[model samples]
Target: MTDTVLASWRDGTAKTAILDFVTRATRQGPDFVPAGDRIATFDNDGTLWVEQPLPPQFDFVFRHWAEEVKADPSLAGRQPYKALIEKDPSFLHGVATQDPQVIESLLKAFARSWAGSTPAEFDAQVREWLATVKQPKLGVLYQDLVYQPMLELFDLLKANGFRVFVCSGGGRDFMRVFAEETWGINKENIIGSAAEYTYTDGGMVRGEQLLGTLDLGPGKPEHIFARTGRLPVFAGGNADVDIEMLSAARFALLINHDDAEREFAYTAAAEASLAKAGELGWTVVSMKDDWSTLYRNREQ
Candidate 1:
């Protein structure tokens, strides 16, 4: 592990709490961690990076779809995806939640559109795209905008025998791309919402040949169970979609982005779920109040 000092945005209280958790957890020395029980899960989108306005992966796919529409012109009149390209905020918030079929259709289209490439090839594409892409609001590379405090926390926990995992609602393949390239974490340890794919002689295949339901919300816990068998000891997230997964953990933390100056201040369906966590004894960390820094500018 690296000798990195973890800082907190709050008045040192959150930092104290975290260090206490780490100390007590490792009090039994180097071999103290519970066998196969040193699991810590994190939500990727809002918790780890900027997700407001749109998720980075969605923005990437939408950019591709938008370019296609520009070529066809007629594609501007199509449903859902068209609305998405036009930057219809309501279309994403409402349709994605209220209309199940719409979400399924969009995801299927994304899978089909990006399929036919080997996992390695697709990962390379994502890495190249992230290197060149900049966030509209932050004026920084998407990868540069990762939360610094959280990154430090990841290292701190790892030093204390915890195996950190990103259990996100974003595309598993997309997250894996960034995780492997930027953090040096193994792809197999990172789990997220996914569309099914089939193995072919040449490479993995998608579309009709692929069969499975997309993972989301409650399905997160199910996927974790199927993959790891052991429940997580610690979990952190910033959305209602993560409630079930958080609830399944022994120690859960919620990152509330309340800093309007540093980051957008907005609320979502995740609030009620967070309230439930409060009642259930989960720790809630306010971004504005708990984090001293917003991002560790990769350019720096």
Candidate 2:
């Protein structure tokens, strides 16, 4: 293994854990996992990118919601729309985060926005948003704010014969739009919350409908099992919602967001999971201690 494998990662417990995992999981090691069984799953939001202040997808939803209220004056009386109109930060924050009802409402909005459209149409909407939208806090495109060290980890793991899968609580279709370009993982490998789609015009057009699964908490492992037919050898997540998924893996990682200057300082969302990591001997990657850099400039 060369130094460049994880150059962006600081020399610490997090980096050592990764190096040791790769070494032990490689062919020469006595504990080597078979290539076929070398499966790794990762949570998307806070684990892969900046989910502070708000989850990135919420930015997309907020805009869509605004347009909805504008087109229909009565929508202004609704809970989400009223909160948005009143600029209630706490209310917006809940909608942007792990709140179950808010998550469901956002999914309904997503369905309404994309239903009766082709896959191409949905992708185009996400593409346009990625191109046009910027994070309110950082003033950078959300796609461009992906953690650089994690991207390096992906390349390293793949080179070592590990098949990676993203098992995220974020909208499946929403993550699929940027997963390939950002993570270098194929869309089929992504396991996220999804809505049912109805075929139309001989399958050329599809309409999004009711959610198939929410993909949070215990649903993480359930969805992963239902989709992959195997439990992952490795898993990474950042919040309590991922506790079940992390617990189900042979090697688990909890990405602790504690870098106040470079990024966010957040442990409240994953406090229970953090305790679990300690009790179960799962590795917790510290954003402040493990990463030397949060993100890098993307090539246009």
Candidate 3:
């Protein structure tokens, strides 16, 4: 109920529901959840940051593919590389909608591109990308586009008894590179589609294979349980791929991006999630109405 926490959230049902849930979960009552069992998970893309124009990880990968195509023009004949050369939107549209088939193709190429590279090398490249690249439309770093309200929610949850984790369909190690600094959570708390590794030359190198299922739809809950050993008691997401993770939670928060003035507004991929939220009575926070502020700097 205090403005110090969730300050970006305007006084409304969405904020009230969050606070009330925390109160009930933390208090010694019938609804009280034990500290160890109070796990919260969130989807990273549209839920935590601006995901419109496609997710940021794709931007990073697309740049690499473009360079590869330039070096070997024949590579442009392939599907994904061809997609890049022709400026095709089908593959990217599928990716934006969390199409598993498209993502598998993307990740397989991702693995092949950087196979045998050390984790340190991959991490350094990701760090440099984050540091140097500015989001095209917003004209600011991707890290700066993260929702201020969500960060405040993280602080509130941690202050209570909850341990939070980010579960996404993006590359696991990629998100882990900046998870701690950007989200203020441990790098180990990021769960997503991951590349396997092989120990060679006295160091671990990325293997040319995706480690497990693509982390989307049902895969979201699967990865969360695989890592944390339990389903989330609290969850938040903005897209359809997050359905299973949100469904597994006792408290589900869905973000509705209905503000075009401050942020893009459309539900091309999230239509089902929006319908499901209404059918299930899930809390849907409107970016237009629910947030007093969108970004930390408030200049964009």
Candidate 4:
């Protein structure tokens, strides 16, 4: 049954555990979860797609910032711009590790970049970026890099009456642009750090202030509960920032990017999460061993 359900997943303990959990959750037993409360949330970066080099959202924002620097040379003196100008690996490393101070700095600038733009305007900008920019190493559009195995898992969960949400620390508006087309999830189901909005001049416009929180660490479950009214029964993530969310779930699956041959492998950001997985007895999915394929074909 697991073989037919999770086609891109190899036979392994991770697969078996997932199948067992789902079966128990669906069956009428002590561990069974009610359908309405069957919620699964996953961290976007690393867990659902490639996040190396930089997260795709940062790549999008950085492109715009580069052009911003070109337009006004004075802005180049500031951080993010300064970091980009000098090609600072430490700044990039901070982002990869989801260092809070680093992310907060970026978000402040991000909010300023499109302060008063309407949703349609923001969406158009994202669409343009998606159409033009390709992942650095893969040479394919970023949207095409979503994992096929994760998508199959989504299908299996949905078939068994689970509501899945993609929760990320990246911009919610950015992900919503391609959520339906790329992840096959409704825009509302894509939860992330978001800017507040104001209704003015007969339209909704973005505000410089972030909505509530930056959606990292504790913010993940906070945002999930705020939006869904409950914590996830199942959750998946692959970095230190995800530990809180993973720990909150009944079944947690952590992805280990140990497949340098098919996909880039490094434990730079995932060390703590891996340790937590071991300590908590959370199921660990090895990219090299558990997944038969790394990505969906570009044509897909």
For model 1, state the Cα shift of residue 271 in Å: 1.6
Error at 254, model 3, angstroms: 0.4
Residue-wise C-alpha lDDT for candidate 3, range 30-63, written one tens digit per residue: 9999999999999999999998787899989988
Give the TM-score comparing model 1 with the true structure, all chains together.
0.87
Tens digits of per-residue lDDT, candidate 4, 1-300, equal 635799989888999999999999999999999999999999998888899878888998999999999999999898889998998999988987778789988998999999989999999999999899999987888877889889999998999999999999988888889888877899999999999999999999999998998899999999999999999999999998999999999999999999887768899878899899989999999999998887887432
Residue range with the least summed lDDT across 10 consecutive positions in model 1: 94-103
Q: Where in model 3 is the C-alpha error above 4 Å? A: none
**Deviation in angstroms for 60 in model 3?**
0.3
Off by over 4 Å in 4: 298-300
Which is the better candidate, 2 or 4, if ranked by lDDT?
4
TM-score of 3: 0.97
What C-alpha lDDT, on a 0 to 100 scale, does residue 216 get in candidate 4? 92
C-alpha lDDT (0 to 100) for residue 125 of candidate 1: 74
Task: Give the residue spans of candidate 1 off by over 4 A.
Answer: 1-4, 8-11, 28-33, 71-74, 85-89, 95-103, 207-211, 298-300
Candidate lDDT scores, in order, read 0.73, 0.83, 0.91, 0.91
lDDT at residue 254 of model 3 (Cα atoms): 98
- Residue-wise C-alpha lDDT for candidate 1, range 1-300, written one tens digit per residue: 122458534555566666766676677775355846888888887888888767788778777787777788887787655787676877788533323354556666777667665777777778887989898987878998788888888878887788888886567888887786555578898887565677788667544322345455776787787778877877888777788888988778788778888887866757776688669977777788787787885422
Clashes of each: 5, 0, 0, 0
